[model samples]
Target: MASSDSTASVPDLPSKPPAWANGSPSVRRPAFQWAPYLFLLPTVGLLFLFSLYPMLYGVWMSLRTTDVIHGTSTFVGLNNYLQLFHDPQFGLSVLNTAWYTLTVVPLIVAGSIAIAVFLRDSRPARLLARVGFYVPFVLSPVVVATSWKWLLNEDLGVINGFLKWAGLATIPWLSSDFSARVSVVVATAWNLVGFYMLMVLAGLSQISAEFYEAARIEGATGWHRFWHITLPMLRPTILLVVILATIHATQAFETILLLTDGGPGGATRLVVQNMYQSAFGRLQPGYGVAQAVVLLPVILFVAWLQMRLFKQEGVI
Candidate 1:
């Protein structure tokens, strides 16, 4: 009886084998917690090399007088920044970027929301319309600019040709300060509206359909339903659209570069274009870097303010 009790008290030897027993293939060892961190090592290394290094180097370069010709750089403290402030072109570019943002952001947000609402139905025709609107957003910025350039040509373009045929005077879409600004704003809006529409549409999809059904049964008119349900539910998406559109507008370069070339009189010269011209066109890398560094703070402040707004509204 003592011998039998001793054999039975051996904890059954785990039926087969322990996890750490030799050659125990069926036993799964505990996962190593560091495995995920090891997998992320390459991504972290690349981001440090490419992103963080460039940003830090750019800041350093901004403080120095870089002579690319002689391959020498000298520390210039804040002179580059001070000179940029005194430059009239810099001021004009800031104003143009502000104006562009103010003009395009509102239109893009409102128009996209309206279009998305009108196209929200899953009917075949509405789906097709959504696709048609989104096609422009996927096109390369160069292609979009080139196409608009031809279409908005003062004399030979299809739009002007049609206007002429209808006995309307051909408008110079790229000439004069007002017309140039308008053209850039309209072209930019057309390119970006689809992205905003898709964002808002995604938000609309998240909302339960039962809300609308209940509202209808309770005698809510279309306008009342839209105001009470749609608008409030869409606040987060609208805020996102506004922030992204503002940033893109501030960096408006490719469209204006191809469409206006900062001319008729530098009317549409945005901040990014100004930076390009300063860095490459004028060979003032240090000054250009300084300008970009200035923009960084402003962009950060705006982003922070938006975050504050999001927090206040519990959108975050």
Candidate 2:
């Protein structure tokens, strides 16, 4: 009777075996298992369509001799690239681009850093100043370029007018090679400084107030604190800004077009302008695409060089 009672206390098992008994899986999925992928599909599709496809197509086009009028292309392998190596105009454009980049990038970085440091305090005046600096960045490139052109006109521009009023000789501003280069650099830097200042301000904000407090307790002056503490902490942000500025300077087009139009004997024509003329103006699409393709590696090399330098300095 005891044994039967013990047996009766045990629970009965179902007659059917478990789902896994016959080597079939029994894991159940949630109803929303694919919801994340479903949401991501649209973004992925758009990227593939717009970004990836164009890039792949451009590379393909770079290898061919494209006749835009006839809508035909012939495989020319690396001939277009070879042709570019011997092209003097292309070489000149590359040199001009380098000079513009080297000049404007430093100016942008320095000016932005100075302005950002000045405006770090939360005073109302500083806030107003910040807004004033950033206003030009938000304006359309066309509008900014047009305004600058008026200001820097050779004879009747506002700046020359002021020079005359001050009993000083007026500058050529845009008519001469040297002055045209200076005008473009000044205009580009002025237009971009505010945007970069905002970036630096963000970097400044990320630094802890405790740092300044600690430095003050150590009898550090303002310059010492900036040099030792602030600059060291801001390295990563500075690196990012430099790389971006380099790329922007290299690819500058529309502003140069509107301001100088590669004037004073193509003094301001950049690589992109050369590429534009090759593809559309000269009807050599393949050659133009080749220039663009080569530019990608140049940009990548610059960015990589920056990364390496920063790494050596322990910035990253």
Candidate 3:
């Protein structure tokens, strides 16, 4: 009995770890704890130098009144921000930016999805269409703006030439305030639609073929299938596009700069353009920095709202 009790109390010998396991004696991992960080050092350093430093410096600049020519600055606290509130040009710029965003974002989103859906075919025509639409987006912003500027020029423009050929009066495409805004919108949309379409296409590609097949099997119509299956799955991607479009529209400067140069009036003067004028053109860097700092919050708020909406829809 005693011998049997002693045998029962004996612990089982520890089993050997598999050769693939980290604890296995046969495998030895190099103890270079700092290697991963070292590999990441370049990227982290670049981010700090370019992104973080600029942002911090901008914030610092916004709080001071700096004479760029004299290389002198004096801290004025929130006076610049107060001046922004009272500045009519700044107010107009804010309004213009808001209008631009409201008009362009919906058009881009809808047009992109439609183009993506239409181009999903396996035919050569569809392949060509995809390439044609996507090509404009790859062009440099300056090139795009320059081409469009010549095309929309009042007297010398091809558009006006065509109007004359068709016996229609030459429309002031960029001379009138309303028409200038409209022209900018059209030009901006034409430039960006291709990129938005590609984004939608990527989302479309992720959706399983079986879903569409099953929907068709149930005798679902094309519209029904799109509304029920495609749109639902593409929601996340659409939100992403909207967020990006908002940012682009809000900060739109180059296209407007090249196309209208803030127009016959101040119709196309966006906030960024105003900021640019204050910073470099007017030599009021501190005022420009304040305008930029103001924009940061607006952009963050919009982005946060979009992300919140995306999260609600189960999108990361």
Candidate 4:
């Protein structure tokens, strides 16, 4: 009877509200409620309307062979894609783009990281080197190409003049297939390496200085610090640089066109050049789009892979 009286005296408590009901009055709140989503609505709507809508529309258009304005072309399905595989020019362009990306991506990533590492602690040196590296990036490509074209002229050019003075043969840098390819790589790399160095510099700065100090206290030398702490911490930056360089290199057209026009005879032609030529010069927009569609998956997959592999690099 005493136990029963004690139980009866205890008051019954009201039940807690459900998670989705966190917006109710006199209820416990959720960690984050609809207010956060309301703030995100505009940006989400804009992306959906602009980027995603246009992309899907493009994909739909790729299936049809009509003029974008007139919408005249009939649906051709996979015909555009099939035609690309049979086109020798398209094949060459694909090969060239792949080769260029393979080489330039690694060089830009490694070279930028090296330069940024060396200059990170030295403000004056970093500033001077940054100026030298990035000046060409801001210059118009046409201006750069025209300037270089004059200097690299096969006959009576500054480059040949220097070569002759040094007892080397005056080679046709842009006129031939092999030399033209090399020229494209060199010209593009010169302008782009600085942009990549800036990226690496940002990554280097994000790393805590205390990590280096701790390493030093443990008697770790320069090489040891670089290997144990620096490289591991910079993995995210390395991957970012690789993805960016890949995109740029894979989309490479302007520099090669300005420098080599993809020949001696189709030597330095990249997929983008081929796509541009097909859509504009050859009047085969469908086929060009098809060639481009082939590259889309490659770029996206690589980026996704990097994010997955370097999940803890703390890169935003």
Candidates' lDDT values, in order? Answer: 0.83, 0.83, 0.84, 0.77
Evaluated against the true structure, the overall lDDT of model 1 is 0.83
lDDT of 2 by residue, 1-316 (tens): 3242111121344545443323224535424356557889999999999977988898998999987888989999999999989999899888898899889999999988888888777556455755787898788779988999998887889999999999999999998999999999998898888888878877787788999999999999999999999899988778878888887776458899888888778898888998998988999988998998988888779879787866765545
Alpha-carbon shift of residue 264 in model 1 (angstroms): 2.2
Per-residue lDDT of model 3, residues 162-223, tens digit only: 99999999989999999999999988988888888877876787788999999999999999
Instruction: List candidate 1 segments past 4 Å from native.
Output: 1-34, 302-316
- TM-score of every prediction relative to native: 0.82, 0.81, 0.83, 0.76
The C-alpha stretches of model 2 lying farther than 4 A from their native spots are 1-34, 301-316
CA-only RMSD, every prediction: 13.3, 15.1, 13.3, 13.4
Better of 1 and 4 by lDDT: 1
Would you list the rank order by TM-score, best first?
3, 1, 2, 4
- Tell me the deviation in Å of residue 69 in model 1: 1.7
Give lDDT: candidate 1, residue 122: 55
In terms of lDDT, the best-performing candidate is 3
Residue 21's lDDT in candidate 2? 25
Q: What residue pairs are clashing in model 3?
A: none
